[model samples]
Target chain A: MLNNSITAAMADIATAVKRYSLVGMLGWQDVRQRYRRSAVGPFWLTISMGVMIGTIGLVFGQIFNSPMKEFLPFLAAGMILWSFISTCVLEGCSSLIAAESIIKQLPIPLFVHILRTIWRNTLILAHNIVIFPLVLLAVQKPLGLEALWSIPGFALLVLNLAWISLILSLLCARYRDLPQIIASVLQIAFYLTPIMWLPSLLPGRAGTYLLDLNPIYHLLQIVRAPLLGQDVSTVSWCVAGGMALFGWCIAIIIYGLYKRRIAYWL
Target chain B: MACIEFNNACVDFPIYNASARSLKKRLIQVATGGKISSNEQGRVIVRALEDLTFSLNDGDRVGLLGHNGAGKSTLLRLLSGVYAPSAGTASISGEVASLIDISLGIDPEASGRENIFMRGILLGMTKSDIAEKLEEIIEFSELGDFIDMPVRTYSSGMHLRLAFAVSTTIRPEILIMDEWLSVGDEGFKHKAEARMNELVEATSILVIASHSRDLVLHTCNRVIWLEHGKIKMDSDPETVTRAYFGH
Candidate 1:
């Protein structure tokens, strides 16, 4: 029975992945629908992100007593990646819930909804990340071969988010208050993950271990470190990779057990 | 060769109330070993469908007749592969289009043309297929220039016309519908009915749930009467409809 359930869940995931055209179009529609009537459209998101980064960078730099020249790019990269991760986690909770109408009316795989959510957020992230290069230029950060590491780092990040979305979407569908709980958790995670402050500010060995223990910090390091022209630490890569594998294992198990229950939950 | 088979299939819905859905309450219940548990905090299971054993082969038009709380819609969902059976099994073979809600994926902010694509994708049509049927769908909807405008601006009748057009445009092996789909004025209803007949005739299998006896007699050859989540009668539409209505 367990093997059969796992096989069925795998088949569902395969079918959802095979229907990429449908998933991609739906994701594009999701992004388009949100900014339909606005004059500035989704660029409004880009503009707002830019303004937020600027304000936060100056204020936090002064507060941390760090140089704006070094700090702005670091803050910008971390903030941009954090936005992507946070939105993926937050909206991931509603990936299936938001698509309840479509789910009920159609016979598509549940993972299709998760893919659509991730893709939609990825599109929005694309819009927000346009500010990154300009910030790098503003901060006089040079482009280097090390910066290319961010490409693989981002690919891994997307893979991790996909599994995370799958698990959260199902769990949140089952438990209605989960989305709110996730939101509050992310609020705490924002401070705990070291997005605003340098890890160096922490006094000693315990601070280093504490940062190491944070999966989000490791996830952030893999992408942000490279984008800010720093070495991509092997420990960060190993932790992020391990998290991806561990997350997928949990996601697949939960999905296998609860795959059929989602429609009922909805 | 579309077919659907259910072997003693059952569906139980765990209706989670607020307290049951909350992690804190559930944890407390688990930790306290039901000592502090209230009935409301426990999971309430509703057996929506029970021991539903049936098979539908090609060229069959089956109508489901049941009271409000009976499992007509649940059966349709089961056939459409929306809800897997909690016990037993169901095997469905087909490209299925479940018209439970024709306007399900319609976006109010999008134009009728864009909604056609959106709704078409949701209906299991590929982008290229929708592109090919674009002219046919728009022509069938009879919205003319309104097709270019946001669906939010459409009158209720116009919106129904667009939804009906996009939904029926698909050619599925098995078509599952709930209730009778009605649209617009008398003229439009006749047109929609004619189009629906054409679509249904082309499909290999049709499962419809409805309270309308005349509709069942007109559209279906076989009928299943459900009472309290069990099949009470399965026979010719004439016999079941007559018995169902006590006429």
Candidate 2:
């Protein structure tokens, strides 16, 4: 039975990966449905995110006693990545639950729902990230080779979020209160991960260690530091990469055990 | 060729109520190792299907007749590959189209045209396939210009027409339906029935679960009567339906 389940789980994942076109189209429809009937469409999300970053950058820059030139770009990159990360966690919790009708009715792979969630959030992240380049230009940040580092950094971030979303989505589907717990945890995570604040402002070694202890902080640094024209730390890459490997190990094991039960759970 | 084989297949549903579905309670149960004695209060297990053994070869039109909660729908779902049996095994080969719930993925806020694609995808059709059948599906729905409008604006009958049109657009080797489909006005029902008959004739195997004895007798060659997850009777439609209705 154990061997059978493991094979079944792998087969399901393989099938879901093979049907990328279906996943992509469904993801596109999800974004389109949310923005239907709007004149500006998904650009409206970009506009609101831009406004939030601008206002928060100004007010928080003054409070932190930091220069607007540095603060604005940092805030923009951090907020955009944070929105992507947090939304993946918050919305990922309901990924399987929200697709209950399709899950119960269709014979498609369970991994399809996970991919659909990740892809949908990725599209919305694409819309929200438009503000990053504009913010960088506004701050007069120079284009450098280091900015290209963010390409790999962002890809790694997506890979990690995919596993995280799959794990959380399954857990949340089985346990009804998991979404609420995830939401509350993300609320604390936003403050803890230093999106609105600077890690450099922390007084000493303990503060530095605190940032190191946070996996979210590591994920943020890999992408945010490079996009802000700062040096991407080797340590952040190591931590984030390690977490991805470890997270997938746990996610797949849990999936192998619980995937067949998901339909019944729903 | 299409075939479905179930060898003593069983499905047990773990009924997780509010307390059972809570992580905190489960965590506490683990931490205390059940010493607190609240672990068993809400864990209810329902055996939806038990030791169900059956097989179907190509060109078999099997009908399932049973009272409510007799595992007919669960059995259909098992054959459709939606639910993996908890025990024993099920082997099914062939493309399957399940009209268990015609509106399974219909979005009320989406336009009928968009819904055709959405429902088509959910029903296992590719985008280009849906595109190829788009005109036919819309024309069959008979909603005309209303196809461009949101489905929420449609009346229930119109909604059923749209769902039925998209659902029947695909031809599968194995077709499974939970109940008899009867929709739309008298004129439209005739049209829908004709379409259903054409699709059913094209499939290699058909498994329909219904309570209608007359309907099953008319359409199916074989019948299986279920009682509380076990096969109560299995025979030809005439014998099974007669036995089912006490004729």
User: Which candidate gets the maximum lDDT versus the true structure?
Assistant: 1
Candidate 2, residues A1-266, lDDT tens digits: the string is: 67776777778889999888779878988888898889999989899999999899988899999987888888888888898889887888898898888877779888898889889888998998888878778878776778889899988998899889888888888889888878889998998888889888888986866698888999999888877778877889999999999988787788899997889888
Could you tell me which residue pairs clash in candidate 1? none
DockQ of 1: 0.71
In Å, residue B223's CA in model 2 sits off its true spot by 0.7
Q: Which parts of model 2 are misplaced by more than 4 Å?
A: B35-42
Model 1 agreement with the true structure over A1-266: per-residue lDDT tens digits: 78887888899999999998888988998888889888888889889889999999988899999987788888888888898899998998998998887776678988998998888888998889899889978988787788889999998998899998899899889878889988999999999887888787888886866697888898888888888778988989999999899988888888998898898889
Q: Is the docking of candidate 2 incorrect, acceptable, medium or high quality?
A: medium
CAPRI quality level assigned to candidate 1 from its DockQ score: medium
Q: What pairs collide in candidate 2?
A: none
lDDT of 2 by residue, B1-247 (tens): 8899999999999887788678898889888877655556547778988998889999899999999999998898898998989999999999988898898778888899989988888777888999999999999999999999999999999999999999998899999998778899999999999999999999999999988888898899999999999999989999998889999
Tell me how far the alpha carbon of residue A76 in candidate 1 is from the true structure, in angstroms, after superposition.
0.5
* Per-residue error (Å), model 1, residue B60: 1.1
Give one digit per residue, the lDDT tens place, for model 1 in B14-118. 887878777787777889987765664456889988998999999899999999989888888889988889999999998888999888888899999999998
Stretches of candidate 1 exceeding 4 Å from the true structure: B36-41
